[model samples]
Target: MLTREWATLPEFAAMALPGVPETRALQKWAISGNWSRPEWRNVYWRRRSGTCGAIEYSYQLLDRPAQLAWMQRHVVISVEDEIAAFGDDKRYADEWRMFHEASQTKQKKALEILQHLDRLHRLMEAGHTLEIAIYDVCREFGLKRTTVMNWRRRVKYVCRHHWLPFLLPGNKGATGPRAACDEQAWEFYRSDYLRAERPNHSDCYRRMVAAAEKNGWVVPSAKTMQRRINELPTAVIKMAREGRDRVKDMVPAQERDRTHLHALQAVNADGHKWDVFVKWPDGTVARPMMVAWQDLYSNMFLSWRVDRSENTDAIQLALGDLVEKWGIPQRAYLDNGRAFASKRMTGGAKTRFRFKVREGDAAGVMTILGIETIFVTPYSGQSKPIERGFRDFAQGLSKHPAFAGAYTGNNPMAKPENYGSSAVPLETFLAVISDGIKEHNSRLGRNTAVCGGVKSFRQVFEESLAQVQPRKPVAQQRHLWLRAAENLTTNKKDGSFKFLGNRYFGSFLNDHLGESIVVRFDPQDLHQDMHVYSMDGRYLGDAPIIEKTGFDTTAAAAEKKRAEKLLTKATKMRLDAEKALSPAELVALMPDLDEDGEDLVESKVVQQFRPRAVVAGSSALALDCDEEQELAREREEMAEVMQLRDYL
Candidate 1:
């Protein structure tokens, strides 16, 4: 066999290049040397005649030494060699598919047969008899001669490049056994098994058998039914056996990116009931509900309060603690619980769907403080980050040594052996919870996305806090969270109002007497001054508590004296101002009467007077000196009485 004059890139790189064995590197070298140029004497390029249409180059592209090296290494190429070179391209598509579809064992056997056949062909080309070559090849491969002959006959007329599938030891057209159960039996089994009731395969098969006996239909064996059930998609099985909610649980939860948020910029609030029995001060034993606010950026529990039960007051105070400690959050992620959705917290929020929202409702804490309220889906734990911390707290705090015997499991079914044996006092339980939350925030190597498994939540929060300035409420705004609001009208007398069994009054309230006003007061401390607002929600002033005192006490006497002095001083000031204008000076300031002695102003209408009729035989009588004097004195007394009445 002669050495081929032209070679593909890979062939040239392998045979001619001694140092650069890679086709890419040789191609680079050929391009740098201009070997493919038409004017180049040693080499030229042409598209190889094949489906691939790759370029091939003459051996002269290499120097004399490489040319001789290539010729020395060349061997006589056989028809098998050419077929092997183009085997990947010449193989029929269906044959390739069949080869891949064949089992691994069959594929291995086919490969072994092909190898032995190649050996047999080489021996025949070496002038050996066909029968002898076949025997030798079969013996070399540990295969029988008959098997080797059969393999050859199977691919006798097939293209050598497409013989692998033919060599595979199986009936190419065979598909396996048909379904054992007929269509009716399959339908019955499927409909019976794939039910929401989730019937067992055996029971379903028995029922199907009974139905078959009645309906005269074929009955499939239990194994066949089980196999058919197993063939159903996993999602279909889960949806049928479990409920849709369980199926929904399989969906991945939304991943929130909180890196953009800073500490106290956004926070989430949630309430968790501990799994430990806590005896309240009132001697009632129950689990304590802890409402907490957690920073979203660092997953740190900023503030929390434990209460006998979850209520609006507990949630409000917890939020107050959060705001007082960490400043106001720009956004609060809350759930639509009764406590969080109360009028005192999120009343005016448009997203609050739990209650009837009225236009006249006062602004809630969130609205008053300008914090954006984001109401999460109800009962969805994934919506609140604080819930994850609550889970950790449940595992750590509920199982603490202090709560040993008091440990009430998270659910009724998971109760411990010593469940309800004892109860931890509320104070002790709160102390333990506080310590647990502190540790939860400061624990090292938290593997949260924000913590990065190295820093604690507190450390992360502080680090971010240094970079951003969070909005903080002023001292006056504390009432927004600390106080609950109520509409109350001041007392009709002295503008005082009774609230929580205490009377509140302020001089400023006098101006709003008998008018309905919004009163914001701390429920925990009713004695404190109540923040007052008008009906339209404008802040008036604080009304201090009017403490009750004994009437006989010196303190009461002193208070009375003080009030008398104030009233007397106020009256004296008004009298002095009035006396500044004397009555005689005020009379001189009046207009002078007309010269004719008739008033300048005249009545618009006039009427005639009727004469009085005297009694018949009436006579005019004359009085002596003493009688006349008495009559004149009586007349003088009557005039004086009339003047006094006009003055009064």
Candidate 2:
């Protein structure tokens, strides 16, 4: 190694080693540099102590004047000998990597040339002439004279360039200047070539050339056009030709923000029409709709329900299952569907609605349960997170071999050859769906959000379970979870209301006679007693069925007897309360009775309660005559009853 002492030395006169070409050459190269002795020594000292900041090369020590002097100076050093003595520089590691990873054919030829150069260098070091060394090396390596000359030239090129042969351009020193084409013309040609119905390279080239000729512009050959087309990025070309909907998936996607979310914190519900046809129980074939709820944070599907058509009932059923199995979600993101927006799902808000809405309806199911509902934009499937799970389900389950003939393509134009030829049974479809759902939940690597580093949806959901703060539903209010329907008129006679063609009686409805009240009931099974609420969601008592006659001998009789007993007890209680009435009030109930037990005239108590007579004229004589006539009529009417009613 060269030390600071040698680097700062004024001349080689004091340290002469004439026989050592390497030493003499280095001394000459150093002295030729325009650095003052102290400056050169300072550089070496800094490098030796590792105090220089990011300065790797010896050339960095020279200023402008020193650089010019050093470049112009005549100096001789065995480049190969110095490289061998100092070993390879780690600073050029990246360059060596590029060389080793070069094309296989170029690497092989470069290695052969390097071996020849190494042999020649050794021969020269042993004090042999160039011609003699080349002859000896060629004989030893079994190479032709011209080949030896080519290898020597390759060595000289590497020595001058300080780069391997493989790292150089493959077509170096070949042919004339490259072919050229107008850039604007090429861009237009590329656009036309990469259309949905793409054109061939040869055709594009021909069209471009014709256009160029007409415009008096130069155009390249077809081969050049083909190479340019190949150079275009595959993904960009696919996007241009195939449309974004088809090729967008090929591009990398970013993970959604779910930092503040936990399992069951927010859930998304959406409906997907399955691609397979199934034989329904009614002997008709149809595609079933799947209403699914997925956790936003964990990517786990909480629950799902299948039906011939998606409706509010199905949505509630799916959500109910989710709530029961994996606690209720704090917030629910729902797609803008007719079923999801139905009053039963979202009708319970008390505030004045901005959209056309029904009045006097109870809070929506989500509102009743304390779950915040967010309605996604209409027709925007990407807005809800559950859509991705449906895509995965279609790929995993709907394409099973059991549904081969029934597998309808997602798009009409993409249907299979045997589409609609056969139908899968409903039971079989349901069984397959169940199995598929299990497998989907268990499949690993779905936690792309990296929540707790879990690999599967189930694992991710379970891991985040502790972070959930769920609002539990009360058991008493569980049945009221469905949507409320239209209001009905309460019967004034008995305070009973008609619902689904059945009469229901509730004592609480007595005060709300003739008023319109909203009724909420399960559409699927109206057999359960319907819940009644006031126009303002006040809990009115439940009404039971008024009549039950068919196929009920024992139960009906028992219910009737129980009703009669309650009625008798109520009558006794009323009679006991009436005992506190005064004698005059009690006498008001009895009137003069005829022998045949009939009263011919109105009782005085009843007559006093009637409205006063309106007179046609208000003269004193006329009033006196009318009064006398009324007294005479009363005497005439009561005379018969007075004679027959001896008890009075």
* Model 1, span 1-648: residue lDDT tens: 335677887987666455545889888888898776777433367777763877787765665345434544553444345346545584355555556666888877777666667656645654568987776555544778877777778777766556666677763322234346767877888888778898898888888888888888865568767866775666788888887777778889898888877898889998888888889999998888888899999999999888878898888888889888878888999988888988888867888888888877777878788889999888888888788888887777779999989998888899899989999998888888888889888999998788888999999999999888877778877877778888688988788898878998887876788988778887778889999987555789999988898745676656756976886798789789879878888889999867898768888999999999987766535446798899999999999789745644
Which 10 residues in a row give candidate 2 its minimum summed lDDT?
A: 1-10
Question: How much lDDT does candidate 1 score?
Answer: 0.78
Models, CA RMSD each: 11.9, 14.2
Q: Candidate 2 lDDT, tens digit per residue, 591-633? A: 8556887657865664336677877665655566778889999
Off by over 4 Å in 2: 1-23, 28-254, 349-355, 378-382, 444-447, 450-455, 466-469, 482-484, 492-494, 500-502, 525-528, 535-538, 546-648
Best by TM-score: 1
Clashing pairs in 2: 344-483, 348-363, 348-364
Candidate 1 Cα misplacement greater than 4 A, ranges: 1-191, 223-236, 489-504, 513-515, 524-529, 544-648
Error of 2 at 633 (Å): 22
lDDT of each: 0.78, 0.68
Every model's TM-score = 0.63, 0.54
